[model samples]
Target: MSERITHRLVEVPGGRIHVAEQGAGPLVLLVHGFPESWYSWRRQLPALAAAGFRAAAIDVRGYGRSSRPPRVADYRLLAHVADNVAVVRALGESTAVVVGHDWGSPIAAATALIRPDLFRAVGLLSVPYAPRGPHRPTDGFAAMGGDEEFYVSYFQAPGRAEAEIEPDVRGWLAGFYASLSADTMGESAGESVSFVPRGGRLRDRFPKGVLPSWLTEADLEVYAGEFERTGLTGALNRYRNVDRDWEDLAAWDGATITQPALFAGGSLDPSTTWMAGAIEAFPRTLPNLTAAHILDDCGHWIQQERADEVNRLLTDWLRSLG
Candidate 1:
């Protein structure tokens, strides 16, 4: 199944983007989130392909083989949306159905929201859609952490996280992934991975030893190798731009995605719980929502943790879009 997938670099504005694609039919562009690459969609590529759709996943700039711009501002949401648009154009297609997981969820939603003509429909996993609002993102994050610093706030300083991650990318990645998975997350129940104590590192709360059921040693190696080569700066930069994204997207404040859409989140995922209000307001935000689901006992890594179910829901939704 893996052999059927092909990889290539498509030229975008700042640099070339690496893309892995499979199958053939209506284009379904898959975008990854923080600390991950195109490989995160390894399962979906083959599944979507076999199900009769062209599935293409990309290293969302700053990860994998994609070009990582030197400046932090380069990783803003608008740039990511532009990259998605360019990738679709470079593929020789005028439009595509975009699906995103984790941070990719926002990127995909922004793409669909900003360019409805190009992205006909969208599927968001792990993260729900919430349009820009009154508060600055950093201010909101700061308030969320209370005494402890939110992980997003911890990533603001340029070299802070890189110093922690670069030393042992593979080991760090193992703990990070485990901390977010349903199986091993209980090890750090009192110490949330999402928040960093005043002087402590985020990895301090991450579980050690066991890998999540969905992640194998090889899977860990793929993610670690990419970050090891590229470093965490590019990926972390996405966090640094939240305020900028909020400011840049203000024109669309309180906007709704009018296009057909689908959302699937893990019951155990903190993102779902934290943004439950957004999900409840789907009727107002995603007026054309096709389906919304919360997979039982799942965690942050939605598509990866529950591949079969997610694949079924995605394919059904994609087919419904016809």
Candidate 2:
């Protein structure tokens, strides 16, 4: 929100991307996840800028002010990875410290893996990037649990999720955000479900209530307004490309992230519980992993949930990269 942080649309390889930037130094690119935009890094933009890094956050393709390609195929990992690398070059940098959360984590990982020349260092939050397995991700996912309306499964069918979530974007956003917070997810951090039964609605998964403290009314408005304009098609398309992404990443099946890396997540984040093994074995998966921090009493929104702590950890990690 400060004048120091400026927004602009810059052209990438395939399309134009909207970026928010501050300060000037080593480039630190922030990539947000599902249902979020570049604004998601509001707190970190200034914090990292003050720490002497040119902090930049982009509205990942199909999200905020970025170009939204019509085909679902365009949202694949290869495309997202290319977009990040192109953005770095377009911003006049040969390399950057790529940081991501949730869906963005995998995208960042893919970038570092496929084009390490562009992403010198990597930081992953909330999600861990396990290398591609022998089986297709969709095949493994489809065989998971029975009689359950897996959120990803629900998102597989184009227009279905959009229909359910677009009508009342605010309500959908509120429920989705609340369900992932520490409050609705339980105080004691543990494994939890992120989906509902078949034919179930997303709102039904959470208690009818107000927005969580981490998400303010203004924050909600920003997300809602963006989704209202862009619709859920582009964002959900990311989920739809699971199999394609898995297949596309076949080249890096057993590869490890060979970059200086850092990871931080909220203790209460379901991803922490769900991907505990990967997080624990990060050093093995990412040979150059420098540090992994788990914020106490925090949830999925690690950066927003605990901005000060995240800023400190991120800055310290960035300092180490130099």
Candidate 3:
């Protein structure tokens, strides 16, 4: 079954961040990603809360019921890392288990590294660790992509990506990844009652863009509502800062996370797998990553699609530590 979660807003560094919580023990601070709200963790919040850990899911800066700052830079990695620190501190916990998915994973990891004092451990859901401390904008562009997948390059292309996805707000963003099938990219159209990544025209052994089939209409609605409110600018802003973050993180040394780290990936989820080879960079940077697991059957939304397994894996990992 799923856990029933509760929502509320709390004040943060720049402004107020909407946070949802349930149960009580230590603390599990969940930061949501782009086009997603605290509601994303609907299944985990109550489960963890009941498990004795105060499950707190906070909407990132510019999504959902949280404050949306017009300035794109406000959503930068540094600002985001600071938000995690501020949220954990604001919650009155010296350190809490921080979990994040998609864009939230990056902030979660950075918080573990830069503000280890404020975090007990970090769980990176889909997007794995990318060791580009001082990232160059040039280093983070569409290294090799096609027209089907645009946001990566589209986000930076003046004002194009966001505009394109606005058509069927729910479908556009949901379709971004829900269009892929068990075999090919964007081919299984109008079959599944839910969403799948498709529509891009391409023919290669690796069809550049492939969305898994976990995002459903209801799921897409949750995401579309947020994008409609935020207009994808604040969310897309994450990509724009590639060049600036590299320079900033490279200069900071004390932020290396040496705590017990866990990396969970969906073998089918291309996001993490895309550059997952970079996982080697993490142990070198943190050195204490105790375990890493790959759900060969799951995808980007592992926590959502494969929640039972994810929860079992997450809970077991947490237990093993003690």
Candidate 4:
């Protein structure tokens, strides 16, 4: 499976984007989220390929082999959308269907929203599409964290999260990943991974010594190694730009994604619970939604945790677009 996938760096506006691709049909571009690289889509590439689609997953700028710009604003939402547009053109395709998970979800949505001519369809996993609203994002996040700091707020101060994650990248990643997995996350709702206690690190609440069934030691190492080599500033920069994204996307406020779309979320995932309103508003925000699903007993890593189901849903939706 690994041998079938090929890798390359496609030049975009600011830098080069590293992409891993497979198969030989219409293009399906995959975008990954925070603390993850193109490797996160390892399962989907082959599945989509075998399903008769050319699948390409990319390291969003500032992660893996993709060029990381120095400024914090470099990772804003529009910048990411441009990278996606470039990747599609660089691959010599006029259009594609974009799919994303975690942070990738929003990026994918924005791409389809901003460039509908280039992206014919969109798929969101883990996070649902919510059109830009009236309030500033930072204000909302600040209010969400009454006493404890919201994890996104905690990531605002440059070098703060890096300090905590750089020293032990592997362990931090392991705990972070485990904390979100349905098998190892804390049982109570108060123990959600979205917040960090005042003066305490986000990983402080992470479970130790337990790895999710979907994540092997090798997988953990792959994730850790990338951050270890590049450091976390570029990746963390994405969180810092929430307010910027909110401002940049203002023109599109309340805009509906009219493209064909699909959404799947983990029943147990906090993202699903937290963004329920967005999911409920899909009819208005995602008018062309083909199907929406909540995979029971699943967690944040939806694709990896439930590969077969996600692949079926994705391939089915892709076919339905025709």
TM-score of each: 0.98, 0.96, 0.83, 0.98
Candidate 1 lDDT over 43-121, as tens digits, reads 8999999888999999999998999999999999999999999999999998899999999999999999999999999
lDDT of each: 0.91, 0.85, 0.67, 0.92
After superposition, the stretches of candidate 4 with alpha carbons farther than 4 Å from their true spots are: 1-3, 188-191
Error of 1 at 301 (Å): 0.6
Q: If both were scored by TM-score, which would come out higher, candidate 3 or candidate 4?
A: 4
Q: Where is model 1 more than 4 Å wrong at Cα? A: 1-3
> On residues 1-322, what C-alpha lDDT tens digit does candidate 2 reach at each position?
3448898898877699999999899999999998788988999999998888999999999998999999999999999998998888889997899999989999999999999877899999999868888887777667664767557777898999888888899888877777677755542223324665676765665646667777889999999999999898989999999999888888788789999998888887878877898887777789999988888788898887788889999999999988
* Tens digits of per-residue lDDT for model 3, 174-281: 554554333333443312212212443212222334444555667666777767777767667777765566666775643556778787877776665565666657
Q: What is the C-alpha RMSD of each candidate to the true structure, in Å?
A: 1.3, 1.9, 5.1, 1.4
lDDT of 4 by residue, 1-322 (tens): 3349999999999799999999988999999998899999998899999988999999999999999999999999999999999999999999999999999999999999999999999999999999999999989989998889999999999999999999999999998888888787765332456788999998888887889999999999899999989999999999999999999998999999999999999998889998899999998899999889999988899998998999999999998888
| Candidate 4 local distance difference test against the native | 0.92
Provide the clash count, candidate 1: 0
User: What residue pairs are clashing in model 4?
Assistant: none
Clashing pairs in 1: none
Least well predicted 10-residue stretch by lDDT in candidate 2: 184-193
